[model samples]
Target: MNKQPSHASEFLWSTPDAFEETKIAAPGTNLELETGAAAGLYGAAEVGNNVQSVWDIASSPEMGAGEDIVVGQKFSIYRCDALLGQGGMGKVYLAYHTELARPCALKITSPGKLTRGDDLKVRTAEEARSAAALIHPNIVTVHALGEARGRQYIEMELVAGGSLKHLLRREGPLPTLQALRWMSAIASGMDYAHRQGILHRDIKPENILICGRGVPKLADFGLAHRIGRGEYIPRGFVCGTLPYLAPEVIQTGDHSTATDVYALGVSLYYLLTGRLPFYADSLEDFTQQILTAPCPEVRELRPEIPLNVAGLVSRLMAREASNRPSSGTEAWHLLNSVLGQLRDVQSILDEALGYDPTVSWIRCGEKYCVRVQRPDGRQQRVFIESSEHRSDEQLLLIYSVCCPAESSFYETALRMNAEFSHGGLAIREVDGAPHFVMVDTYPRGTVDSEELRKSVHEIAEHADQVEKWLTGEDRN
Candidate 1:
């Protein structure tokens, strides 16, 4: 046998395959378990062609319950119709309720492994109890427990979308309304738990879930615990998401609500910029960045961020808890303000970018020519004409000018997005007339095609208000 080693220096342990493997322009460790074409462009969480919608599942004692199982394998629960993801301590599967058929995340843990580590005991037990105790819309529910064939595990809600890590990797940073909508949900849940005397000591983005664009749920409470009561909880050993842990955790060896705030700040920064504020080669380097580095400014990254939003982000990441909002209600109000501004931006983008024509009109003149300019000073040209101009009967003409003739007019005229309402475009030769053709989604920035349409439509309908509005009004 040939004993020569091949790349023996390669580390046995590695980051998430999906994310770490994919190269990105940002700074951070890859939590992405997989990469798709969408990740290459928009990012991971939003990569899938289809979006997932979830049915509301109730919270009950059954949620906390689960059946046990051995390590080194996955257990499928037919009732839940969900596959639990694998984990280090054990594996967790998604299961549905027997009677309700509600979705749930069922975790399978081996008793043999649990008995082996005293260190894992607190967080492990707390995962079940604290998650069960703190009930909220944003938190994943632990439904029930069961055992079969020498295996044991607990059942929880099946949050269809995977972790936020997957979401961010698949979908780029979410739009503002969606981002804040989710943050509000998470903060509210954490606030509820805080009031209930619990703290998610291990709050991190990996523990967060983006069920869809707006749906977010918290997970992995194995480190959750009753705040004040955990005083005697095995001193010396530290636990929690490293990047998010507060400075106090490093210096004083004490954990507090302020620490949670710090983590929240980190999460907010992540959603806004799609980049971590601080990135390092190792955990120690990460700690250094968190402890010493000044929080990066959001406005500098996304210059379009509103004044209030920039201010709010700055305040949340103030490196001082005293600067943060007093209560969850206050945080919600601040978040609401930011979300409002973000909603306006999205509304503008949707309105400015979408087009739907209520009526059809024909252009039968050589004067109506399409001209487009590219970023590189390149120009494209296209001309449209109909045999006879008509008002009521609809006729559409699309021109795809090749080569130097690649202007914006043809691009805009050709586009028809399926996701939103679009002007119904059908290509049919009208008894010896030219074809009515349409184009679709563009590769990057909007071409002058849209602007050119406004100019031409305006010139065509100068006299009649109806024509002007019909041509320029729906600009979408």
Candidate 2:
């Protein structure tokens, strides 16, 4: 028997793992649960005192007029193979389409869950219609919508890689670069949807599905509202996961592009620090904190996070809706700018070597090389490479050729290495022959544009001088 949370809010707000045991309802049920009354009923209505042990009665086949859909169940041209997941809406099954011979996710609404004039049924249809209209690489594709045995069902693209929530649970906080990549992709997708006049009122980690290639696609448009179209919600009921809800949405029940941006920011924060910005024992305190408290600085929690990246998160999570990015377009641009600052080796090379005409660079396979012309019209080519020294340290290697290595030159090279100020001479194979090379290194993590520029210049000059001294020619 599992221990039940003391309050309904606790059960509703608990980590996703706690809800895993809660049986998945039948497919095609509306995904979003209207909070407050509905949430309390879900938490307390089923089992007497054993709240956690209570089965999800709303989605159970026993509660419905139709029989439970078991493995190998067929609905039209699709055949259900296994259970994928279950949420507030209903169960999702891994199904294969016989006509198209493709895999898809089948979501069926539990029979008897819908009553005459039930807004949930309308919203369920709207979710399918809304998602089916927008066909973007980052947004999940809805295949078809139909009814079987008095139950409504939706066929959607099967994203093999699980949700961001599952990723966070399996692997704690992600690496900074990887997290930024996923967020940037999500922002682009959201921007596209916003331009289509649709607002994803519910944006959270669980709703973002990653594919096998690691591309994240926005999903579950159950709470989506089209801009400029007045949508109605029952008074006092808010729709969205609590921790990711925006301040304005919590206070006034308004949904806008900025509200979506706020949720994306909160999701990014969760990805960077495996915890939400606000948490409390009760729903009242938690809502108050979102309404009034200042969002904690991201860097305060993870000091290594770039300052500008932290600033972007802070701007997105601003308490005032007006203080955040006006739209997904603005947020996408802001995210991309921050990505430029957290430079990789290639970006570092582009910054240091891209502008000058006197220097030319090319990438061959994984190795990068730059040819620099000395003041005397002599030319020297320097190679830059990256390698991991230990699990924690990534090293950037910069080397330039001096001359072919020879026994007679060994003693002089050793003596000249002592006289050099910046890089040292080492014998390395170059073009199937051993050559004396000038080498320098820096930790890739801490290396910057200015440092790379100085190293390249110094290494080029030293190697050119050594070549002139040993070979008496301009051979690299």
Candidate 3:
């Protein structure tokens, strides 16, 4: 009897997400089951994300040596040409469209990035092909994937904001609203893939790109695969960033939409607090923590975290398979519910009955900016910025209240004390008038787009609160 070949003989398996093609399952591996009755062939892919399937695995696969790329080469796109950058996935040349006069990003993978031997080459091709099939606003569109001069390359949209890693490292965690805004766009992109029956196994900060316009584009579908089909990932390998992997991914190699949600939740936790839910004091502790430890409570780090927001992400971090949100859609809803009621810090302070800080008071502009130690002996500040734009939600998590630094990103939703800066904090009047002014501009992120937006919003919101408090007292 002739054995049927698994649909494993194709490169560029198209389903969803931008980078789903990198993970390929070995189709002809052996499996010993049930007391060694009969060895079976297993095609369990270690790269869990639905990837491109390619047939015809030759003994020797094609590869591009890095030295092969020409300094200025062009690729064809929709009625145009574009240049590629000389970086990862081969030299990415910058290209421009002549007819449309549009610029595009083109990349060619060098053979060096694919050193895992014969089967891995086939898998890489599948990844390129799969990524080629994905097209979304939040996804860098793969214009095409093909080989030139024994080198395989892909053409994609050139987003301006650069990588999320660059942004986060530069500025730190985003304002709650900004992070949510980016997450929503990312979810929409993931939703596009799920609609097409694909799961992004490698959902980490690095793979998510931020466009210059602050739009989030989910890229790097190099490890994606179909729902099943031996899962098309590398066998016995969890191919993704260590911090974002779901519990199931490490245990049984089972992946689905829930896996993506788990990763997103982890990303959000890192985003809001600028800290991981589980930090290992050591390597052993790190692995063990992933296996059995629960994520830290958001409130424990920053008291300002909205209760609904914390609980929402907490549900996604559930260890049990059945407990987490079924899909990114559900996660999106939960996120919105938590973020819907945006309020200024003064209101929150008023509701909390206000706080009195004992420290040095320095005048920032006209308002007083007070610096004080938190209840946990950590230093933090409570100041306000007035903004009609963010009258709803006006606070930021500069850092953990448990570990506040002399300067942090966690600007309070409260008003800044403008009387003095003697080290501790207190709200005092200036010229017999209540006015909270924020005058600190610490560069948090590597670059400052998100940070700038956050600061401007905080400053405006702080000013608004001072005006409100003054008006309310006048009426009384």
Candidate 4:
């Protein structure tokens, strides 16, 4: 018996497949439960964990309706092909006019999600009517508004390019100049609308649509109400996206042109940082933070952001609505003035190359040659090229850093290139030698001096990492 115990211990301790049994539950706890077989089924309402279902049934006599229109289904004159998007109150579908052979966006009301009264239907029609009154190049065109089978729907222009929100989600942040350009365009659109006595209370990124030509167009004027034209928004009736809501608007639910400016400023902040300034777990917390918290410095988050640009954005997002720009036109002019003081990319690069203590750049025809010393005491030649496509809105800046391309590191470079955030490494043959290179591109006019420096630093750091990896000396 002693030998047997010893043998068991040896097998348990030394064997590769041996494992200890583990127990998670209390030693004396009862885990078994009573069970029955072949029982008759009960109603869905009588099933397990039916508290929510029971509450739903007790609250309403009839449940809400499901999606009414499917693919190829005709609600009225329009044939629904695909669903573009949906919201709490309705869904926007891609539909085509049967008679006119035109494509349009059909927004239909979801009766159940809206108020029990006819307010939503009325508002849906009002939204169409309000937008229909305006005929601007930067506004979405509304064709018709009608009711079909007791459901309200509106047919409008089908904007091919998605909203700025989608782009912000894909790309972390935008270049300062590009963001300024888009903001200027939106301001121009809203200025025209304000002149027409329409107040766009909702002016967030989701409401700005980029067209095929990269031109920003103001959209979703559903929350718009005509001011100084006998249209009165009842006091204490708040209507706007919460994050962009002005302090006065949140406190009293009174929206004004200043409210739109505040929202535009918030949108600008979002475009510059790809995030909201204030975030909270609850509505109370959010309201408190937004109304009371001091605004964060934009340059702290993006040091590359120009001081004057940051100051303008900060002023636009001031807590007091009066502190903001009086009108969108005025804001546009302010941005133009600030932009006028900023140096062009070529000039900045030339200045960086000329007088910068750490870096040197020389004009070599259309391309600029930047000389950089790597950390390992190796010298690297980076070529900069700025090209403007005839159709592109901004100049494209390309930077290429050249190195000897080893076939063993070619695959690694390709992989790194695919995964890199700013740019990628490539293997190009130059005079019978494989040249390993890293390439990055940025918009020319938008790349500020600080941003340019950061890009160069990032490229240099990446080149160092690549060289180390190639030499099998990578410590990371």
Candidate 5:
């Protein structure tokens, strides 16, 4: 008798709000089970998110220092120009489409048992292709799915800014408003995925990418489930990050929309506290804790977090899955309500900057300009706008002066940029003339009066310095 390979070799894999009244499943009555396991098997490796699979592959002898795929390698219609990074499931490359002349992120994986045969491979590819059918701004667009020399590949929109996991690691605990905005965005995307009959069995920070403009895009649908597909996994097997898994999933191997909600709650806790809800040294200990222990309160770790936001997290992480929000749609609305109850954007900005309303500041769309008079009787113009390409979603302040577009000015601008760390000077063409500008950016929502004042002063001071340089003044 021949033994069949298990699909074990495969794949990998936010939000807040509100005191809004909504229906939730009654504790005992909400134990419905959905088939299929993801994030793969309930072993000790399940502690993290989809990355656990990467760890497993890395430790395996098969993942030895494989031959490096150099730049300009061809894969069907796409050419691999650079290796972006590697994950548990496969290696990601920066590839270019020869036909379309566009760049894309190409994820290559063996998918183990999922690719055991021609029929299974074709079916799995079709299932993954279904992900491409999903169209939403908050979700990463899956362009195409194909196979090259038996290796499965997915072509997707390349997000340049990196992942939410990277952001949390770099900046401890996000500002309440920014975190709420991301949470709402993720919830909206998740709701859309659920409505399309897809369950994101694995929902964690690592799967949420922050785009160039600071908008969140949910990625990694390798563990996604198509509803009513009659997929099944043995009872002991499980998928999903253990820390974020709901009690029903652990006890019965059920991966449903509620489980995703539970993961969202765990992610919210992480977003506001920069820590997991539960921590343990062993799998058994972690399992017991997740199955019976209550999630720690977010306010205890970060008291500045709004009460409604914290409360929503606790409810979403409720041990009984039914007690959590029934679906992402409900969670989305709840988040909106919580956001509405918070401070208005204009008030927050004004309060943080200690602006004098009598100064007659000018507002145009998202850009705000203010005129300042220097102590030396010089007038300076300060223009602030939300960055068009923001990796951190901050507001930028610029001070500029018209200058001749000459080699000397370009050299000075480059030198200035290299010398400064806070902000840089640049020359821009306006109406065929050049303007030398000084610009600085600060995180929005959380920047206060002292910081804003300092930034304004620095911009004005730098603009003057640039003007002096252009005039050949010896002022250093």
Candidate 6:
């Protein structure tokens, strides 16, 4: 609700090679690597090895020799058009299918800098397999995985709008309603993936891509792992963005549905505010704060945020995993419950006046102004707005102007107010001038379609009559 300074990153967090060898096998399989060898595999920031900032990767002008896939280069029936982005893992290009002429995102593996035994090609295939297995509307569709010129690649659906990180960087914090909608949709996709025994180990804003019309599609399964697998990673090997890593994952090298939910919670907090929950000068301090400190109340920064929504965010970012929502399904339901409590006046007005030829309305910011044509051919404009009373009760205020407030007409307006049975006569300032306004009030949460329709018609008719009687003109 407040316009805070933008802290969005211009570059994305590069996926480090530490997670390349992180085993992602089928369920019921035991995949184990020596702790000494894999000790820092997941600890990108802790290791301080190949963890490059977004700027470092974005500033690189060229890829390593034999790793660059040039534009217009035909590779396995796909023609590379332009480079979308490059990170520690690989370079993603906008490509097209030569035969079908279909556009897609072509992600090519960059295995030049990987550590020994870190088979990036195998990891790339695993990423494709893990993502391709589950098909959902919110999940980015993976088409195929192949190889050309010794470089492995994945073909995915091309999302034109780009990633959530880019969106936030360009357009600071989003509207609470729009952010909630996107979060709920992403939760549905995560629930589907969890049901299929997949854990999206990485669930940051950069990994979530936005499609046309604001549809959020979960992308980047590079760190995804199958559930129920024994010893999925060596202890102490953390594998996720430092800011979004769950406390349990940071303390113990474990990944679960709850961990994913924790990351989603952190992502939600970032969406609501323009910055992360905790900030520190170094990764160790940041990790320590996450492990020991309680998350600050979201409402502390954005007080206008609803209590339920703020509480949900707190629960999602609980230091203990057991306190979290458990899975995306639970989170989705909670988010929907909050969404259900929100009252959109514009939507209510639309439902009330959509089919009436004599009624037309336009929304300006949070308020709606409707023009109603009375049966007598006179037109009056009615305004509907949401306000909070001193008692903190949310109310819908409906009003229409009658005429300028003059000392001579004060007694007549008071007399008419007593005669009226619906709304009362009030003097409110309009364009810096006091005017006699016919005003009505209703509880925002309980205002219904029929009541809204009746009030709009009555207020318009009454205000038009008053204007004609007092001023003998059709001026508002």
Cα TM-score of candidate 1: 0.55
* Whole-model Cα lDDT of every candidate shown, in order: 0.47, 0.72, 0.50, 0.62, 0.62, 0.69
What is residue 27's positional error in candidate 4, in angstroms?
55
The residue-by-residue lDDT of candidate 6 on 1-476, one tens digit each, is 11111222311233343321122222112111111111111112222333343323433443464456678898789998876655444566778999889998777755442322344445556657877998998888888988777666778877776567557777987777668778877888999999999998778776777776657888777667779854443333355666777877766557789999998998899888867888775445666788888788878888888888898789888888888999988877767666656757877787778888999988878788899988878899999998765322467899999999989888877877787778888889999999999999876644556788999888888888778877889986
lDDT of 1 at 248: 61
Question: Which pairs clash (backbone N, Cα, C closer than 3 Å) in model 5?
Answer: 38-239, 54-88
Model 6 misses residue 93 by how many Å?
Answer: 0.1
- The most accurate candidate by lDDT is 2
lDDT of 5 by residue, 405-429 (tens): 5776777667766765556676667
Candidate order by TM-score, decreasing, is 2, 5, 6, 4, 3, 1
Instruction: Please give me the total number of clashing residue pairs in predicted model 2.
Output: 7
lDDT tens per residue, model 3, 49-126: 222222112111433344554434443333223222222233344556455667665555554444435565566566
Q: Provide the TM-score for each candidate, comma-separated.
A: 0.55, 0.65, 0.55, 0.59, 0.63, 0.62
The C-alpha stretches of model 3 lying farther than 4 A from their native spots are 1-66, 73-93, 97-101, 112-122, 232-235, 281-284, 343-476
lDDT of 5 at 272: 87
Q: What is the C-alpha RMSD of each candidate to the true structure, in Å?
A: 17.6, 14.1, 15.9, 23.0, 13.9, 14.5
Question: Candidate 4 — what's its lDDT?
Answer: 0.62
Candidate 5 at 147: error in angstroms? 1.7
Each model's backbone clash number: 61, 7, 106, 1, 2, 1
Candidate 6 overall lDDT versus native: 0.69
Compose the digit string of candidate 4's lDDT tens values, residues 356-467: 5655667788777777765666555566775564322344354554457766666777776776787677666656877666667765433446567767766766765676
For model 2, the local distance difference test gives 0.72
Candidate number that wins on lDDT, 2 or 3: 2
- State the local distance difference test value for candidate 1: 0.47
Off by over 4 Å in 6: 1-63, 111-119, 230-235, 344-476
